[model samples]
Target: MQITKLELHTSCLQQQRKFYHEVLELPIVEENQNSFTVKTGTTALVFSQAPNTSSNPFYHFAFNIPHNQFAAAKAWLASRTMVINTNGKEDYHFEAWNAHAFYFLDPQQNIVEFIARHNLSNESNAPFSSESILSVSEIGLPVRSVSTTCEYLKQNLSINTWQSYEDVFAAMGDENGLFILNYIERPWIPIAATPGIFPTTISLVGDFTEFTLEDAMYKIVPTAK
Candidate 1:
């Protein structure tokens, strides 16, 4: 489902304004001293003020670009910041998936990634570049419910369920847009974004219409599948 908007809090506005808008190059919805919103597909994620928030309330996400423009996308991002992960890897070539991906850290240290290939969705052989961003590719939400949330997303968002294993529920939608809903217990250990954390992330895939509902309900926790 596309995330229309996500409202969360950040302790530092300067950093928030720069990272999402400047660094990641997402479009801004609105901005003030207290709050800011950035485009994530059809949805805009709004960030407010909060200090040392635990569970992060949000996890990590990815973006999809035209398969052919992988080189140009990487070059553009490299011009801004290092594309290497904290582990200093330049790219993760998934032989199993036939995809090439790279990651970067946001102002809040969220692991943001750019992927060159997606197994699902409308593909373009035209080539990828900064201008070829298809849409927000994947979103991870830290929730307590796995099956319950998956069912709700299936019924309302038209997301196709692919698998639910361990604490991760995998789904796909739109064009090559895949999301992983990470579910875990309430008490989560706050790990550094260096490698990222789990049970505390929500990803917005596809258009922004998915979050327009007043009651954007997602399940919390569910028993092991």
Candidate 2:
């Protein structure tokens, strides 16, 4: 399943504003004192503020670019700042798949990334630019536990796990339309649509058998009912 969009929250408006609109060079479609919108190729990446947010809900997101454009994207990003190498450059290449990419953190320390894969196709090059990302290729979520989170994904979410080592569970899309729920050990807070905070609850929560991220799940201590 392909990712449609991602909504994240941050506390640093000026920092995030500069990073996303200036550094990333995404076109700010909407803006105000509290929030802003940028084109994520085909999907839209909107940032907002949150109140009463939990460290448990914080996360980072990533994308896979065309292999040919891998160097180009990296070059473009480098032209902006050398911070693209915020993550370790030693572990950049995957020996198993020969994929190339890099990672960095937003002002919030949430890991962000861009990767290029040999197995994936570059055929679907739709109308896109650095400002407008096409679609969310991958998503990251921090969870307290992997097995319980995985069971929630497998049962309630219908996501199929491709592999599981220890604390992480990698998965692709099922009929529910999800790709790669990379679970980690950190926590994240949710922001609604305020633009400059980290305590907003969530956006339109809906019920779709197709999985529109309608009900973005949060980890809970199941009751002994």
Candidate 3:
């Protein structure tokens, strides 16, 4: 599956626009007084201004970078801002997934990750930059029950757990894209310490028929083609 678009709420719209358009160097495809959209490879990430009463909304998401550009991409990001450190490490290697990743926080305190999955031949000869980002690879969905969400996905979308599964955590979908279902209030996997669950919307494409899932805090719409 491929994430075509992701909609998020932010209390700081202008700061987010600057961070993504100027700091991250992503092009703003659409903008207005209330929101802005940035082109991130195959995904269009949209951030709308939240209501005054809304809490400081945040989420966790990952970008798929070229397999061979991990170091360059990390350096590129580190040059602009501090790379998040967890357990005294600035990067991570998922041996089972054959991937390496590093994280940083945006102005909205979102745990943004740049990951390179060596299992895929998405290597590039061009220099590493924001353009090297392939797409939004993963989205963390904070649900009350991981098994319930995973089961719903399995029965409806026919997607199974990619690699890991537990009562509190389950990764659905495959390497190209995944829905990381975490138990509510579970801290995201990063130094951000942000809660996993939030009000989020994701629009994606896949091989199966179109479908939609809605809950109190999350919504997923998939377009089949």
Candidate 4:
């Protein structure tokens, strides 16, 4: 399923605005005192202010990049910020998935990724920029039961798990986008941080059904034809 918008909570809105707008150079679509929304390719990432008692939610999310510009994108990112190395390697290739990816941390210390899926054929010779970011394609959803969560998504939304391991992790949805259904306390790959469930909502294309799983909700909405 394609994610049209993803709403997440942040303890500090000013910092988020600065990082996404000034630092990353993403365009701000709207804003107010307590929250703001930034355009991320086809998706709108909204960060809202959270209460002091609420722990800042950290997530592992990825952006799809043009396949031909992976090298340039990597170089551009490294020149601007530190890239997180997985097993002492900054760039990673998943042969089975036919994708390349690298990770970094945002201002909130949430793991952010840039990935190129070879199967999609998004190739370009132009210089890579924030605009080259295709979309917020993947989100890590930490839940108590992987099977139950996957089943719920299948039954309610017609979304299926792309890959899985019993009680460990499940990659749900297609290559263009995925919901990383990870078991709670499971450390996210290439990092030491364990997944945590903070408030989040995702609106998917072409479906208007809304449902909650493990306190996080998903809303289906219309997609532009």
- What order do you get sorting by TM-score, best first? 4, 3, 2, 1
Model 2 vs truth, CA RMSD:
7.9
TM-score of each: 0.66, 0.69, 0.93, 0.93
Q: What shift in Å separates residue 191 of candidate 2 from its native position after superposition?
A: 24
Q: The CA-based lDDT of model 1 is what?
A: 0.57
Instruction: Flag regions of model 1 displaced more than 4 Å.
Output: 40-43, 51-58, 86-88, 95-98, 118-130, 156-158, 166-169, 172-177, 185-225
Candidate with more favorable, higher TM-score: 1 or 4? 4
* Model 3: per-residue Cα lDDT at residue 141: 79
Q: Which 10 residues in a row give candidate 4 its minimum summed lDDT?
A: 216-225
Least accurate 10 contiguous residues by lDDT in model 2: 189-198
lDDT, candidate 2, at 220: 15
Q: lDDT score, residue 85, model 2?
A: 34
Compute the lDDT of residue 95 as modeled in candidate 2. Answer: 52
Report the CA-based lDDT of candidate 4 relative to the real structure: 0.84
Candidate 3: which stretches are off by over 4 Å?
192-196, 207-214
Off by over 4 Å in 2: 52-58, 84-91, 95-98, 123-133, 172-225
Q: Per-residue alpha-carbon lDDT of model 2 for 13-127, expressed as tens digits?
A: 6677888888888888888877777776654566665443344234556666665566666666677765443233412676554576676567766566677766665633433
- Please identify which of the two predictions, 2 or 4, would achieve the higher TM-score against the true structure: 4
Candidate 4 lDDT over 67-166, as tens digits, reads 8888888888887778998677888898878899999988788899999999897898778998998899999988888888889889877878888888
Q: What is the per-residue lDDT of model 1 for residues 139-208, given as tens digits with 9 covering 90 to 100?
A: 6555456667667667655667755565554444543445565654432112342222332223443332
